[model samples]
Structure formats: structure tokens, C-alpha cells
Target: MKLYQTYASPFPTRVRLLIYAKGLEVEIIEPPGFHASTEAKGDYLKINPIGRVPTLVLDDGRAIPESEVICEYLEDAFPEPSLRPADPWGRARMRLLSRMCDFYVVMAMVPLFNLSGRSRRHWTPEAIEAAAGKVAEALGWLEDYIGEDGFAVGGALSQADGAIVPQLVLAVEWIPSLFGTLDPLPRLPKLSAYWRAIQTDSICARLIGETRDAIAGVAAQAKAQAATSGG
Candidate 1:
């Protein structure tokens, strides 16, 4: 199996975390052509028309596009050291929390990125403040649903942790106030404790490190471009 992924993206990074944590024997690739800049033409585009990262192409030429589905496929294909809970409802709850990261949590950050990019003039500080409020609400929802033992689902690392923690890192970086007023910590008790707990998990720390590296790489490229263009 070959996985086209990049650590810069939360979706693909989560997928990579799953692959690594499970000790799966999949080949990972991220050539320049596989990146968004060269999305117009590539072997990646032939398999995944969307030209998105985290596309998994099977040995028999089967392509799985979405990260959530790709993780699910991995669970079924390589059941040992499973990231999913065995019980039916436990599985459903796990899925619910992961989906919330997509539809609720990260969705709040979309407006901020857009405001700085294409629609800067249209957005104001007031709009950003409102979006930050929404992000807080979404974080509250996750905190409420967090398992009692501190991990997303329990004492073990599930798909929820793989999917959610990368986004949480972005959340704290983008909105520093979410960390709290006096100390840079998660607002809620469960969230605060969970944040500290996941750090000891080497796989989570490694994936988060990948995100930081990718961020630094983008900054270096931007600096080089600005110097060359005298911008």
C-alpha cells in the first residue's frame, strides 16, 4: 500500500499517526508533484481527482480518498493494535468525536484563515472574536464528551485522539487565549489534563513535531520568496 500524505495537513497527519502507531507497512510519499502546487498533473491526480493529501492507493489499484475512511480501512485491514473500540456504541461515540473535529472544531478556524487571505477586507476584529467564541464552544463540546480516563475514548489511543490532537495543537497556536488567561493551558479541566497526557505518547508527539517542521518549512519558503522578489 502507498499513502500520499503531508504533515502540514491535519487530515493526513492524523492518518500518518494511525499508520505509524499501528506499525503498518505502508509506503508514504510526498514529492513536489504530489503537493498542492503541482496538483494540476500527477500520478496522484490520476488516482485521486480531488488532488488532496492522504490518498491511499491499494496494491490492486483501489483508491481511498477521505482520511476518516482510510483510517477505517486500516482498522479492518490491520486489526492488531486497533485504534477503535470493540463495542458497537463505543465505536459510535469515537466516530462522533472525530467527526466533530471536522464539522465543528476546525470549521471555526476556517474563517480566520480566509479573513487573512482572500477576504481580509470583509472580515473585522469583531468577526474574528465571534469565530473565537465559536471555537471555544466547540472545544467545550469536545471536553464534555471526552472519556473519563483522559484519552479521547479511554486509557488507550483511539482514532479520536489521532484525529483530534493535531487540530487541538492548531487551535492553541492560532488562538492563544484559548489556553487560559494566567497560564497557557487548556480552559477546561479534562482538556487541560488530556493535553498533558497525550504528550507522553511518542507517536502523538512525533506527529505534532512533523506539523511544526512543516510550518517552519513554509515560513522559510515565504522568506526566500520575499527576499527574491523584494516584497
Candidate 2:
């Protein structure tokens, strides 16, 4: 099995964490997607038409795209430690939380990434503000769902929790000024604690290493450029 991934992609980070947790021995291929290299765009697309990173190619030559789907496949293939709960309701809740993170939290971060130095010309003030607001709203929803539980679903470390870590880490790194000091949603003590706890895990530490700073530097430079251009 081979995993094509970019260090900066939250989607890939989720699968990488799952692979580590499952103790899977798959070859890790560094995709050129992170730097917007044409190789990833052209060659990768032959494998995955969407041209997304974190493409998992099985030894049998089957390719899997979409991070959540890849994680689901992994969970099914390797059930030890069981990231997804056994109970049907529990599984549903976990999937719900994962989708919330994907569609709400991750999607909100897309605009900011588009505003990075490499893509700064695409950023607009209106888009940034809209994305920021969506992020805040998504955080509130997560806080409500988490309540006093230590994890997102089943009251334990499950797929839901795993799915959220990379996005939250990215939020803290890219939009620190917005989510760091300010308690945007003060009622989310459990969620806040969960974030802190996940940060200590080695899988996350390894997968997201350096990318956070790199992405932040890109965002900062873009913002500076936008300001200069506007002035």
C-alpha cells in the first residue's frame, strides 16, 4: 500500500494519524500538492481525477480519494483499537461529527488558504470576513456537541475526535489572532481541553509538524501584501 500525502493538508493528516494508530506499514509518498507542483496536478490526477492529496493506493492498484473515506476504509480493514464505535447509534454520531468538521470547520479554512501568499491575489476582504464568521459559528456548534465530554463521540477517542484535530490545529496556527486569546465560545471548556490533549499525541505532532508554521507564514505574508495593495 502507498499513501500519497502533503505535509500541510489536514485531510492527509487525519489519515496519517489513523494509519499510525492502526500500526499500518504503508509506504508514504510525499506528493507535490503542498507546493502546488504541476507533477501532483498532472500525474496524480491519472490516479485521482480530483487531483487531491492523501490518495491511498492499495497494493492491488485500487486508489482511494477523500480523507474521510480513506479513514473509513482503514477502520474497516484494521479493526483493532476500533476508531469507529460498534454501536450503530454511536457510529452515526461519530460520522455526524466527522462530517461537521469536514464541511463546516475544514471548508471554512479553505478561504484562508486561498489567501496564502501563493494564492493571495484571489483573496478579498469580504471573503476573509465571511470565512472567519463561518469558522466562529462552526466552533460554537462543535462546543455545543462536545459539552462536557472529552471526545466528540461515544465519550471516547473515536474517529470523530481524530477527524477534528488537524482542522483545529490549523485554526490555531493560521488564525491565532482570532481563536487563540479570545474565548469566542466560552462554554466549550471540554472542547478546548480536547484540543490541548490531542496536541500532546505523537501522531498529530508528526503529521502536522512544520506545516503549521509554513502555512501561517504564507497567510501572514499574503495579508501584508493585501494591505499594501489596498493602501
Candidate 3:
């Protein structure tokens, strides 16, 4: 199997983590999408018309796109140390939490990444503030759902944990001063701890290297730009 991916993509990171956890051996090709280059765009589209990263090309020449679908396929193909739960309710809960992270957390960070020079002008203060608020609300809901439990769903490191860990890492990367901190959302102590724990795990640590520094670079650039614009 050949996995095409980029370092900074949360979606790809999710699949990488799953691969690492399962100890699956496959060829990894870092595509040019990370540098915003067009080289991989054409070639990747031939394999996956959508041109999305984390596209898994199986040994039998089958192409699999989308992170969730890739993870599900892995769970089915390699059932040892299964990530998905056996019971129906457990499976439903894991899927529900995964969707929450996908739609709520990952979707909310899309605007901030568009704050480049030309794009920044279109990023209104109202819109940025609104997106930040939505992120906070979503984090709070996640924290409440987590309570004292160490993991999401049935309180184990199931598919829900694998799905959410990457998105939360991205949230901290794009919005460093936002969720996971004590001041912004005080009720998220458990969630904050969960984030810290995941960071130290071998699979997550290997997948997301020097994450704090990477996030700091982006956040610092954004903060400096905001100060210069006086908006």
C-alpha cells in the first residue's frame, strides 16, 4: 500500500495515527500539497479525482479516499486491537463523536487558515469572532460529554478517540490561545488533560512532531498581522 499525505493535514494525520497504532507497514509518500504546489494535484487526481490528501492506494491497485472511510476500512481489514467497538450502541456513539469532531471542530477552523494577505482582507472581525465562539461552544460540549472519563464513547481508546485527537491538535495549532486552555474554557479540564495525554502517546507523538512549535509559528504570525492592521 502507498499512502500519499502531507505533514500539516489533520485528516491525513488521523489516518497515519491509525496506521501506526495498528503497526501496518506501508510506503508513505509525502505529496507536494503541503507546500501548496500543483505537482501532486494532477497526478493525485488521476488516483483520486477529488485530489485529497491521505489517499491510500492498496496493493491491489484500489484507491481509497477520505479519512473516515480509510479508518473504517483499516478497522475491518485489520481487526486486531480493534478500534471500533463490538456492541451496536458503542459503535453508534463512536461514530457520533467522530462526526462531531469532523463537522464542528474541523469545519470551524477553516476560516482562520484563509487569513493570508488577500484572504485576510475578506476575514471580517465579526466572522472571526463568530467562528471562535463556535469553536468554544463545541469544545465545551465535548468537555461536558467527556466528564471524568479518560476517553470518548465507552471510556476507552476506541475509534472516537482516534477521530477527535487529530482535530483537537489542529484546533490548538490554528487557534493556540483558544480551546484546551484554562482561561477561555474553564470547564474543559478533562478535555485539556486528554489532549496532553494524547500528545505524549507514541503514536500521536510520532504522527504530530513538534506540534507546539508549528502552531506557535502560525499563531504568532497571525497575532503580528492583527496588531499591524489594528483591527
lDDT of 3 by residue, 1-231 (tens): 889876566777767767877889989886654432324465677887887788899999999999889988988898877877788988888888778888877676666555432234575767667766777777776776652455666755676776777667666554645432223334578788877766666666675573444455545665675677684
Q: Model 2, 1-231: lDDT tens per residue?
A: 999986667777778777887889999887655543324365877888887788999999999998889998998898887888789988988888788888888887776655554444455667667777777778877776762455567766677766777677666555656333333434556678877665565765565564576555545655676566672
TM-score (C-alpha) between model 3 and the true structure: 0.80
Q: What are the clashing pairs of model 3? A: none
lDDT of 1 by residue, 40-110 (tens): 44566787888777899899989999999999899889888889888888888899999999899889877
Evaluation by lDDT, superior candidate among 1 and 2: 1
| TM-score per candidate, chains pooled | 0.85, 0.80, 0.80
lDDT of each: 0.75, 0.71, 0.69
Query: Total clashes, candidate 3?
Result: 0
Ten contiguous residues minimizing lDDT sum, candidate 3 = 177-186
Choose 1 or 2, whichever is better by TM-score.
Answer: 1
Query: What's model 2's overall lDDT?
Result: 0.71
Alpha-carbon shift of residue 62 in model 3 (angstroms): 0.8
Predicted structure 2, TM vs. truth: 0.80
Residue pairs in candidate 2 whose N, alpha carbon or C atoms collide under 3 angstroms: none
